[model samples]
Target: MIVRAVVEGRAVDADARFALEARYGHFTAMQVRDRRTRGLAHHLDRLAAANLEVFGAALDRAAVLGSIRAVLGDDLRDAGVRVYVVEHDGRPRVVATAAPPTEVSARPQRVTAVAYQRYLPHIKKAAGFAQAHIRRAAGPLGFDEALLTTGDGLISEGAITNVGCLSGGRLLWPDAPMLHGTAMRLLEDLDVPQERRPLRVADLPGFDLVFLCNSHGVVAVGEVDGVPLRQDAETLARLLAFYDALPWDPLD
Candidate 1:
C-alpha cells in the first residue's frame, strides 16, 4: 500500500519510513522485469541527481498504507519506515521516506537531453552530456545549479523541482510539456499570478525572482551565480501562508 500522508512543516522522522512498489493489475512478473530493465538506470540516475532522498513506487496513499498493514499487521507503527512529514498552518502537506539531503552544484544552467538535441548529435547522447556541460558552464559563471529542459520552450519543471518565476510581480510557469504538479495547481488557485506560456532562457534575466517549488519544500532565491534575485519577504511569507492553508487534496 502506498501511504499518502501530509508532510507538515518539514518534520521528518527516520524511524517511520518505508519504501513501496506498485502492483499493476495485469502485467506478469516477467513483463514487469522486462520493462524495469529497459530504462531503469536512466530513470534512477535522474532521480539520484535531483537529490531526492526518499522515494516509493506506490501509485497513491491507499496502496502504500495497505502494504505496510499487510507486512506489519497491527505492529506497523514499529516498522521503522522513516516517513518524512511536513505540515503548514497546522495541516499536513508533504510526506516522504528516504535519505537526507544531497548537495546540488550551482553553475551552468541545467540542460536536458530533450533540450540539447539541436546542439548535440542525438537526443539519447544529449541526455548523457547535459550534466557534464552544465557543470562546466556553471563553474565559470559562479553559479551552483543549472536546469535543463526539452528546448521546446517548455520549462515543465526542474531536474529536481518545479520552476516558479516572478515577472512584473506575477507568478508564472511554463505552459506545455510540463506536468501540472499538485503544488503548482494549488499556487494557481491562491490567485498567485500565473502565466501559461512558453518560457525562454533569455527571459530569466527579466524576472524579479526565480524559485523551485515542489511537494517536499520551497527554497527561496539565494543566488543564481552573480545574478541577484529579487527577494520579497512579504510576498514569500504570504505565499507560504497561503500554501499552509490549502487542503491536502492534490486535486483541489
Candidate 2:
C-alpha cells in the first residue's frame, strides 16, 4: 500500500494538489490489504518501520529504495509491490508512502502474479511475477520487452521497465492507471511519437518496433522468442538519447 500525498501551504493533500507523493513498498499484498482496510497513514507507518530496519534512518534514500523491493517480497503475495514516484523539479523523487486512489470501485480488478525464470525458485514466484508477464507476452512476439495494459484501460510498463512503441510512426503511451515512471517522463519532450489512446493486445503486431524504458535505461527488443520484431536503429537511437538525458542522481 504505497501512498503519495502532496503538501501545499498548510494542508497535506494526498490528492497531490501540493507537491508530494509517497510510496510505501510493502512486503506483501496482505499488508496492502491490511492498509487498505485500516488506513493510508497506518500503511505509511509500516513502510517507514520497514525502511528504518533496513536503512537505519527515516530518510535513508538508498536503503529505502534498494530494500523496499526486497522487503515487499518477504510478506507480499507477489514479488512486486505498489510504487509511486512523483514529479519534482522536472525530475522524480521517491517519497515512501502515498494515499490510495479514491475511485477504487467496490469490485476492484485482481492483479495476477507470475514467477520468472531468472531468480531463485523460492524467490522466483515472489520476485519475478511482474517480469514473468513480460516474458510470457514477449515469448510469442520475439520481443524482449513490451508495454502492458489491461482490458479495462490501465497502462503500465513491462515487468521491470516501462514501454514505448511506435504506431504509424507516432510515439504513444496509455493514459492512466499506469506507473508514471521516471524514464517515461524524460521522453515527454521528445518528438519520437506520443499517443494517449487505449491500445489493444491484438494491435501489437502492427507496430514498427517496441522498446523497454526505465530508470536503468532503455533496451530495444532483440528477440522475444519465436516472433521476429522489426528493429529500426534510428528509433532505437532516439529512445536511447532520451534515456541518456535523464537526471540520474542515484540518490533520488
Candidate 3:
C-alpha cells in the first residue's frame, strides 16, 4: 500500500503548492509493526527540534501521533510510516502517511564519492535536491549511491543514508556536520564502540569494512570508487540481529 494521508476539511487539492513563503520543513520515516514504531521518541524529538528551528514553535507530539494513528489504524503491521510536519501558509501542520514496508537488503553496494554537503545538517528536513541530483548522476553508471564530501576533502555521508567505517570492532564516523541518523543513535545506545574523526576521500580505498546504514538496516559496501572492500560478514550479522530485536512503541 502507498502512504495515503487522511485529509480533512476544506479538501484542499492534493496538488496545492506550498504557500509563497513556505519553506521546507521536517520529516521522518519509520517502520511500523502493530501500529507501533522503533526509536519512536527519537523520531518525535527530531520533529520537535526541527519544528522549533523552522516554524519557531514546538511540535505537538500527541497531536502528531494522533494524526499518524488516524491513517495507520490499529492493525497495520509491517508498514513504511512517514511523518511530515510542514509549514503551510506560514503555520506548521502535521501530516502522516503509511505504505507497505520496504526493506533494503543487507547486500553489499558499490558507492562513489561526490563533492557536496546538505543545507541543514542538524534538522531532518524535506530538502534533498542535492542528494537527488547526485544520485541521478551516479545511478546511471552502476553505482548504488553517491558519497557527499566537503570542498576541503573531508568525507561527510552518502546521498541519503549514513556511512561508517569499521575498524577493530569500532565504528568510525566522519568528524563533520551531518544528519545524525536515528539508526546510528540506536547503535550508539547499544554500547557499540564508535568514534568521530575526519575522513578523507583518499582513505576510502583503504577501509577494511565500510557499510551503509539508515532506518532500514545495515549493509556492507562491496566496492568504493572501483576498489573492492573486504566485507565483514560477522559484523553485518550481529547488526541485523541486534536491530531486529529493538522494541516497538505504540503511537498513543
Candidate 4:
C-alpha cells in the first residue's frame, strides 16, 4: 500500500493524478533501510539523465534525497521507496512514496517466455503496458514472471528484472538491447568472470544456474520454459554475497 506522498516538501494523500496526468517520465526505486542503499550515485545518475530527457531539467540528487528522507522519518528505517519526477501542469514535480518492502524469495522462481520487447529499452519510464499485460497473463498460467524475448526468439530480459545465466561460475548476460539495471552494473565492475552474449531459449540448458537481478536483489530461477535449472543453495548464496559486497551509500 502507498503511504503518504511528498510534493514540494509537504505531505499529502497519494493522488492518482501523478499516474493519470503525467505518464511520460522516468523514475527509480530502491529499498531504504538504515537510510542507505546500493549504488545510490548510480540511481541518481539515472535520474539525472532520464529526468533531463523526460522533464527537460536535471534533478538535484541531494534535493531528491531530502524529499525521500522527509516522507520517511528518522524512525522508519525499512521500506520500499520510489522517487518519481514528471511534468504536471507544464512543470516537473518530484513525488516520493513508501510501501511495504518486497522480499526476495529464497525458493527459486519460474517464468515462461513472452515474445515482446520493451520500447525504448533504456529509459525506466513509467509506461509499461505491454510488460504488465504479459506479467498478468503469466500468473494465471502458473508462472511467477514473464521472460521477454525478441521477435526472432532471442532472450532479451525479464519483465521486471535483468536475466543472467551462470556456467562454470561465470555470468552470461544477454547482448540484446535492454535496460542496464543498477545491480548488474555493480557486478560488472567486480572480479567475477562475465560476458555479454545473445541467448536463445534453446541455450538455457547450457547453463548450470539462472538468476534474476534487480533492485530487490539476486533471486534464483528454478524453471524457464519448463526447463529446470539449478536451484542449489551455494549458487544463490554466492550471488547474494556478490551483490551485498557493493558498499551502501548513505541517502541522508
The candidate scoring highest on TM-score is: 4
Tens digit of per-residue lDDT, candidate 2, span 1-252: 433322221223445532343222222111232222212232344445544543354633444344333333333322213333334465433433333322212221112222222322111121344565665766564344444455542444456555567756688775434444445556776765577766544444467766665433456554332344566777766666665554422111
lDDT of 3 by residue, 79-133 (tens): 8876777766556767666679878776689898888888878777765666788
For residues 1-252, write the lDDT of model 4, one tens digit per residue: 876577655676656535632466777888777778888887888889888777778787777888788778766777888887766767777777777777777778898988988877878876677888889989988898888897777998889888998888788999998988887787777566899998987788678788888888888888887888766577667777878777888877
Better of 1 and 4 by lDDT: 4
lDDT of each: 0.41, 0.42, 0.75, 0.80
User: So what's the TM-score on candidate 3?
Assistant: 0.89
Q: Judged by lDDT relative to the true structure, which candidate is superior, 2 or 3? A: 3
Which consecutive 10 residues in model 1 have the weakest lDDT in total? Answer: 23-32
| Residue 55 lDDT in candidate 3 | 85
Report the candidate with higher TM-score, 1 versus 4.
4
Ranking by TM-score: 4, 3, 1, 2
Give per-residue lDDT, candidate 4, residue 59: 85
Residue 247, candidate 3: Cα error in Å is: 1.7
Candidate 1 regions off by >4 Å? 1-61, 68-145, 150-154, 247-252
Scanning candidate 3 in windows of ten residues, the lowest lDDT window is: 8-17
lDDT of 1 by residue, 41-66 (tens): 22223323222222232223443333
Clashes of each: 39, 25, 0, 0
